[model samples]
Target: MSFDDDPGRGGGDPADDRFSTLGGTRQTRTRLPESTGDPYGSTRRPQRGSRSLVMVVGVVVLLVAAIAFANRGSDSGSSPDGQSPKKPDAQSTAASGTKPVGGKQGGIASGYAHDEQGAQSAASNYAVVLGSEGMFKSSTRADIVRATHDPAVVDGLLSRLDQAYTPSFFKNVGLNDDGSTPSGLTFVSRTVPVGTKVAQQDGASATVEAWCTGLVGLAGPGSTKPVTQTWFTITEKLKWVGGDWKITSSSQTQGPTPVSGDDRASTADEIAKAVQGYGGFTYAR
Candidate 1:
């Protein structure tokens, strides 16, 4: 995360949607009151104030070029929706040696605990898990559902979700239920948090909304599910549980996204090949 010249702080890294309506007897649900948080809230994230003084038009153009360049990559490289990766973060690092370290657990995110940034980081990371490929895999889904979400929603949400993941869904992701091999396809399901903000914060709790983009697709021969992009916001109502931020409840909604550019969409096979051939990084704050 070098801040030498780029703004967006030396602005970031990337990857990459939805919300639900409420129903009666469904328990108390708090809809995320529509607030965009602070899109330009770099005041808290800055280590020095010197950079803020310069807002060169050429620099803004440079930043835009940088963003576009950073986002250009394969499906395996970014948020499922193919957005740019999270730029270098000042707070999180591979050296931080955070949770579930390297294994089946390698995908587990860490570094959040008591700090306000930590709270927002946890919510942002958890939001990614809440919307990943694991959600469609029965066993993996169970593990993630338990680790990231409220316990009450685990069972019912799982049941309802199971119904939603039809053969059509699996076919789209190049997966076959029973968690077996789905021929030559590489299944792609991932969520990338573009940016996170502390909508409201206090010592014991925080509300962090992770703006994200995602992909749910099949990456093999003869598959119809095109790897498409989606934009959504995930508002996590977090509680400082056991010294770590845990999601008490979370909800989603559609885009606060910008218009798409004319970048050439990659082919299903090219996307699938990329997914299978590549791996993911452990996202940090």
Candidate 2:
């Protein structure tokens, strides 16, 4: 089951064709075939059975440990029936040893600083903020791009982002022509990550996935736009730049989301009006 605190409002997957493109956990730097796909017919071999047994036992142990850790909290993961609420699918990712950044103060967990989880967490949070409502306004954009993006990418990305946040895009998101709100309308575009993982990790870098759900739109009197949700993946190229793990580049993509439910839908006017009245939050894993 999907678990969004708001229980309302959403987006089709959006992507940034910038310095680096984003991808999901499935979008790994390398593709590995299942054990059943023994390209050389090695599956028939039995000489290495002893070694294989050791490996299998080790794997079982690790899986048990991981499940225990993840389930440590009442709010973590899903229940036995597999229907616990989670963050967006895009927020957790990894590529082997590499992990997403966990916190800003943790510094660059990249370059294999021995903190893969922290790195993945950092990347996920950065992606959420970069793809947030702040991206629409010039001032907020500057702050977000500066804070979340690497300096090397800031200048060029800012220019391109400005171009992308065109007047039409603003209108599409239920904002005014200038990307402002109507007197009473509240425009919302918020992304909250459910969890993060390192799909593939290396000493220097790891592919991180931030499985996320978002709310975007406007709410106010006479407004037609309503809040909606979406799922997507955000792939990032993280570098241990400066003293921290800065995002050298990133990109987005559509889900991997589930089919919509038959829940009663909210009216457009109500959605629009509600958007104007409610404020968004800073989501976490």
Candidate 3:
């Protein structure tokens, strides 16, 4: 079933009709008829008044244009020799200049640089771990929480999450009471960060937002809860602890979701195989 059709998984309408552009009304201009015979019955004197007005308007427009051009040139960072520097392409998906971290902790990327970019990377990776299928299982969920959260919050976060992913919750998503998938079915829960933004940062702390897309549910021929896609933004409050970024607190809101696409849904076998074949990335932006 489509995500929207599943009452258990609440989501907004896929039709993006919330916003619309208002049509502008056209303005009509009435032109005065030229005096064919000089209504005053005297010489028009070449309409010097109108001619002077036009000249004044033209000069004003030219002066404004010249000023604008001068300002633009100054702001464009042109060299002293009057040539502009080559700009990097806006559409380029180039790797960042920061070096990748060399280590992992508890199977998750760790040892991030202690900078804004590092905090962003940490937040994104944490989002992925928190949104994974492992979070549904008690044992792995404890490991994930301990690895991703600050030491002070790990116990409390683990306790809360354990309570949240209850037996009924597991069954609702086609998982067993122990969060295991039924035989012959594949349970899929994965989050891929599309981008990261540092909302706030200081010497020891940062607030980062990870815009993510995820797949969750069961993938199999007879599965009632087939894998469905979701979009969400995960905001993490991170602190530089133990020489690396760690989550102090985190929250998720539904989405800055895109409209649903027209692509046909893949079969359960194809989806299961693809998930098994393609590994997720270790985001570092």
Candidate 4:
């Protein structure tokens, strides 16, 4: 079964809204009133003072135009060709300046630094593990729970998760009662984090959100459940424990989804081979 097909599973990805600025100068043109038959039909000559005033006004207009030209030329953000640089979006997939944590526990990234970036990193990696195929099995699920969750909530979370992935649940998803796939079928469940954000943080705690995409299902010839992709956001409340970040609680919500494209689905064998050839990542902020 696909991850999103299960009612208990949560899904989503972050959506970004972009905005642009527009600017223009309004010009007011003044014109002298046309002569109305030149009172008494007499031709009039311009006075010297009137001519001098017109010269002054013309000079002022030229000075203002020059200043406007100089200001535009001095805009550092514009290129030599006069186009403004395209600003980067607020959210990006680029790597953060902070270095990733150097330690690992139970094969998962651990020992994050004590900062908001650290919390974001921890949340991303935890989201991957929590949404992985291992969560469907008893032994590996326990290991994952213990590795990612705070010690205080470990037991309770384990019990709840164990009940959630019952034998009936396994059977419904094309897996055996013990959570094993049938012969010649490969069960796939993987989550890749797109980006992370620290929603709120303090010296000892943080609330982080992880936007992710995942693939889940049974892949093989004649498989009833074909591999499918899903997007989701995971919100994790973390606490500083044992000198590292640990999940105190977590929840998931369905997507800021993108429009689907028209593409052909690959054969089950191809999907199975791709899953085997690809390796998962240890995410960082």
Model 2, position 70: C-alpha lDDT score? 77
**Cα misplacement distance, residue 137 of candidate 3 (Å):** 1.3
Off-target runs (Cα >4 Å) in candidate 3 are: 1-81, 85-94
lDDT tens digits, residues 6-74, model 4?
322234311111221111111222234556778766544532333465689999999999999999777
Q: Count backbone overlaps in model 2.
A: 60
The TM-score ranking, best first, is 3, 4, 1, 2
Question: Considering lDDT, which of the candidate structures 1 and 4 is the better prediction for this target?
Answer: 4
By summed lDDT, the worst window of 10 consecutive residues in model 4 runs over 17-26
Pairs in steric clash, model 4: 11-232, 12-231, 12-232, 12-233
Poorest lDDT segment (10 consecutive residues) of candidate 2:
19-28
Against the unseen true structure, what C-alpha lDDT does each candidate score? 0.65, 0.63, 0.81, 0.82
Highest-TM-score candidate: 3
Better of 1 and 2 by lDDT: 1
Which digits, one per residue and each the tens of the lDDT, describe model 3 over residues 145-173?
88898999998877787788888999899
Using lDDT as the measure, name the better of candidate 1 and candidate 3.
3
Between prediction 2 and prediction 4, the one with superior TM-score is 4
Best by lDDT: 4
Candidate 2 global TM-score: 0.56
**What is the per-residue lDDT of model 1 for residues 36-61, given as tens digits with 9 covering 90 to 100?**
57686434332323333244556898
TM-score, each model?
0.57, 0.56, 0.70, 0.69
On TM-score, the stronger of 1 and 4 is: 4
**Clashes, model 3:** 0
